[model samples]
Target chain A: MKHAFLDEYSGLQSPMHRLDPRAKLVGLVALVVICVSTPPDLYAAFAAYLGLELILVLISRLPWKHVLGRMLIVLPFILVVAVFLPFFNKGGGSYNLGPFTVSAHGLLVLWNVAIKSTVSVLAVILLSSTTPFPELLKGLEKLRVPRLLTTIMSFMYRYIFVLSDELQRMRRARDSRGWSGKWLWQAKVIGHMIAALFLRSYERGERVYAAMLARGYDGGLRTIYLYDFGAVELGFVALVTLFPLAARLLAVG
Target chain B: MHIPDGFLNSGVSIATGVVAAGAVGYGLYKAREELDEKSVPMLALCAAFVFAAQMLNFPVAGGTSGHFLGGILAAVLLGPWLGSLVIALVLLVQCLGFADGGLTALGANVFNMAVIGTILSYYFFYGIKALLPKSRTAFLAATGAVAWLSVMLASGAAAVELAVSGTTPLSVTLPAMLGVHAIIGVGEAVITVLVVGTVLAVRPDLVKTYGYQPPVPRFEEAEVNQ
Candidate 1:
């Protein structure tokens, strides 16, 4: 019932956390662009990006353990793609390790991916850990993000748990019925289960829409509360834009 | 499959951002007729649910675990326009609040994960439903296949973005992305089938596609007789 998975650390108090959501949003975007645009061989530029991120991470006051833990989630996917680079990359000199050969070019490719992805992931973890979800959505809206997308997202975030709970209940019921899907024939049972879920979801959508109609909803959504962009927000934006530009200049220098 | 910032070039990021914004705007216009006061709360709750479900990683092979993209799941429950909008919103919040995706790269993330993933998945699933037996069983199978294909397709799109931007050579990037993601699609398909199946059993009334059917009438006489 109480799931704070998405914004677990958003409520923390820190300079980075105190900035307006819009500011953080803009600043991080700029930072990511700068980081991504750095040529793959620009080891110096990557280091600068890492340093900038580290300072921000510390400023946010998020637990190192938390950020690292969240990042670990993507490591497997990163590795799966980059793991064989050394064997397959044809550009560099090859080294024979018994049956397998490793290429210098492949090693570079692996490093390029691992480093960029890790740093980028850390930057995101820091942002999410610091900003609350509702405020974040508001920030996007204020920045002129489309209302329809936000509305849909807000609903998905809200009800995904309800659906998941429904799923758990069904799984429990199946288990109670001695439905152990270990054999090939049992796969059909799973298929039936899937069909049943689709029907239920379809029905729920209708009820939800009907409920919306009952609430005097006749299109055009307007909110009573409007977010004001304050000095803190402006400063935050300046800092975000400035940091990346500075990083780029330093890399070029 | 949300690529973080710094993964692709600035041009790609900005271009994708504009495209993402355009799609979201279009989606909002289309869903304008749909979002009333009742649907508002449901939309918010579904977004929260998507966030939660993404946290629980199911194990893939070789000690790896992957999270659900939820595009198909969302589309199956909500129609495509609404579903795509919801996913775009989630990605927007993810980039800003959670920083799960890049802020600058937000546009690209949305274009791939939200627009491409949700819209494409929805139409594909809908197409399959049309071609198949329209039986509940056929819908389930179609959902599974569509969901799987959508994930791979989304990944392929991302691969193309990276290639065009020249961030990574297409030769290395495209094959690498498609290879791993094709396997990831299996995970997406299984989770989608399992979750979709569960919802079908208990709350058949809740599903949007079933709205055409009249509600099951409660027999007052049976209760009184009992």
Candidate 2:
């Protein structure tokens, strides 16, 4: 039940950490959109975008290993998608690379997916590392995302740990009963465990509702005001937006 | 598989995004009618349970391990509407909080895993449940089969989206995704059957199929959840 820190680096003190969560949210989306929109041939722009990400990473002072590890999680999936692009893309000029006739445009598509996904995934890692989950949800709420969605997200974050603990206990109980699931028939027991977990969760949900009802949970949920973006935060937002635009303008299309 | 940004073009992203938003909006509207004040926490908690369960890697044949997708299980344990909404919200947390998936590509991801996963799985369960014998064993087998098929179908949906996005050609992407997911489907089915089967055996009332009741709690003596 050890909690993984999706926002592990959020508590660190730095300029990036201090920026308003909404600004960061909008800025991160802008970063991804700008990166994705840039043409594949714009290598210089891609390089500059990566540079911006590196600078943000340096400012946040998160462990390089951690950020790199996070990027690696999706790198393989992106690679899988990019791996086939060079082969099936029929519209491009062809080149003999030892055996396979690789298309030039296909190569460009590969480069497009590789570099863009790297930068985009990096930007996402930057956003998650910089902003705490609660603040991130509050940011979304402030940006006028539906109240119901935000409330669910908040509850999700809180209860994920408790439920994981329950799961671990079930696993331990199963192990104690000498069930290791080597045989196909063992799925029967695992089925029972999942059912047990669901029942417990259902019961817990009802209890949670009754408690909420006690405190007057009117159909809608509301949160008090606590976040504000100052002049400096606004400037940070402008910088993130402008950097990508600058790269787009400067990088040869 | 969680698709990142830049893999999809704007046209495809916007199209899927609109579909996803429309589904979410409809889900919220329906949930308001279907859910009592008590149901909201349950929905959120079940969503969190899915999140937690996903982290638990169960070892399959040979040496590799696989995680639970939980779309079918969620749809069966709760109804389809809430189940899909639960999964969609889980995607939001993963995308925004964990950066596991891209923000711009959220729509496509949700469309593939949540919308397609729940709707397809629920109907498959219903169709299969009708054909099977009226026994707990038959029900568990049907649930497992649906879970396995749900993964394949969801992956197929993603493959189509990727092909449509021109990220890769349909000829190449479809078979590749389907082949890889066919293996992942085994794990999904096993987990779903095990968990759902156990719940049915112990407390049939909690299983949320059309006929079975979900064991309403007696709230006369309300105790706070600690």
Candidate 3:
């Protein structure tokens, strides 16, 4: 029922929140690319990347709990994919870790996936936590992202909450009806629920289109330009961009 | 699967990014003809539907749960062009709004799930459907089979990308990813079939690719065939 979680902290008046969305998008994505592109053995560069991310996090004033909580979503993936590396990789020669034999190559691969993915996810979380969803979409549109895609995304964002609420209601209704959904054949209930949602959404889309046309629907969606790429945004972008690059160069040297 | 930012090497990421960009661009161009002004909102709403449906988790074996991917399902409902775009939109939102996937790896994820997953499943469903006699069971059976195969193929693509990025060896990643997804795909197949079957029973016209109507000459039918 509550939808504030999408951009819960975005309204806060921190410097990270005040910066232009375009600046934040560009700068943070640059940080991610540089961080990911860095060599796996570049511990110094990884430290710098993580350090820069932390500084931004602090500057943004987002709760450590929220950031860490969001980071946990990727943990299962890391464990499933990377945790097996040390056991499977035997390229760099094997070393016994207690009773288990592990390879240096596998351990390095594990570290690479763990660190890179963590830092990258954090960068995105920072970007999103600081910028509201509408502003982020607007920023994307301004940054030469295709208008069609952005418009589609904007509409999708608007309705995710509505549909999810409906889904929750259906789940409650289903559970209240005493259907456990345990047996494999019971997947039919889930399927029917999805079908119902799809039909509701489709009909709603048509109604929305008709309403838009009644009020003169056009191919392009228009919004006021509330963003200014001034000196503050420039400096923020430069700091984010140059800090990671410098850290990477220093690591190489 | 949503690959995080750091797992893919620059080369693999860029290459997939290029391929994804090209495919998305092409999809947009083709989808334009079908999506006129009227259906734009419909497409958006369907995109939202897919995103929300994905959040609906179903029970799997041993008390485990697997959520819907909605790639092949969307393709079945809305043709490959618009379906790919819808799935890509969902992926982009998940990456940026939710941080479910990595920004740098967005292209790779899009390529695997949206492009390969959606388009591949579309053709597969059609190819299979054509082989069977015209019947409700045949249509749904084809949807279920293609949905299952689509997940395995997408995961296989992801494993290959991981191997190419030197994140994992092909031998290890291939069997491991596919082996796990093989079970997850059953859920995908079941859900996809039920949804498509329900929609077909209720409003067959809403299903873009459902050929339940008698053979009639329609402008859209020609486009669908191509």
Top candidate when judged by lDDT against the true structure: 3
Candidate 3 Cα errors over 4 Å, as ranges:
B214-226
Error of 1 at B102 (Å): 3.6
DockQ, candidate 3, comes to 0.63
Instruction: Give the lowest summed-lDDT range of ten residues in model 3 chain A.
Output: A1-10
Candidate 2 per-residue lDDT over residues A55-172, each given as its tens digit: 9999888899989988886677777777867777877688888988888877887888778778888888888888888788889889999877888788878787788889888888
**RMSD (Å) of each candidate, 1 decimal:** 5.9, 5.7, 5.3
Query: Distance from true position, residue B208, model 1, in Å?
Result: 4.2
Report the C-alpha lDDT of model 2 over B16-80, residue by residue, as the tens digit: 89988988887887777788555569778888888877876666665466677899988887878
As a whole number from 0 to 100, the lDDT of residue B81 in candidate 1 is: 74
lDDT of 1 by residue, B1-226 (tens): 5665545676787798888888777766666567544455556556655655565555565456666778888888777877777787677666554546656567888888777888877888877788988677887798889888988888888888866764456787788788887877887788777777667666655556534365778766554544
Q: What share of the true interface contacts does each candidate keep?
A: 0.35, 0.63, 0.74
Q: Candidate 3's residue-wise lDDT over A84-111, tens digit each?
A: 8899888888998898999999999899
Clashing pairs in 2: A190-B194, A191-B194, A191-B195, A191-B198, A192-B198, A194-B195, A195-B195, A195-B199
Model 1: per-residue Cα lDDT over A26-78, one tens digit each: 77766666676566677777787788788888988888888878887556546
Ranked by TM-score, the better of candidates 2 and 3 is 3
Model 1 regions lying over 4 Å from their true place = A1-4, A92-108, A147-236, B53-68, B96-98, B126-128, B132-134, B167-226
Accuracy of chain B in candidate 3 (TM-score):
0.91
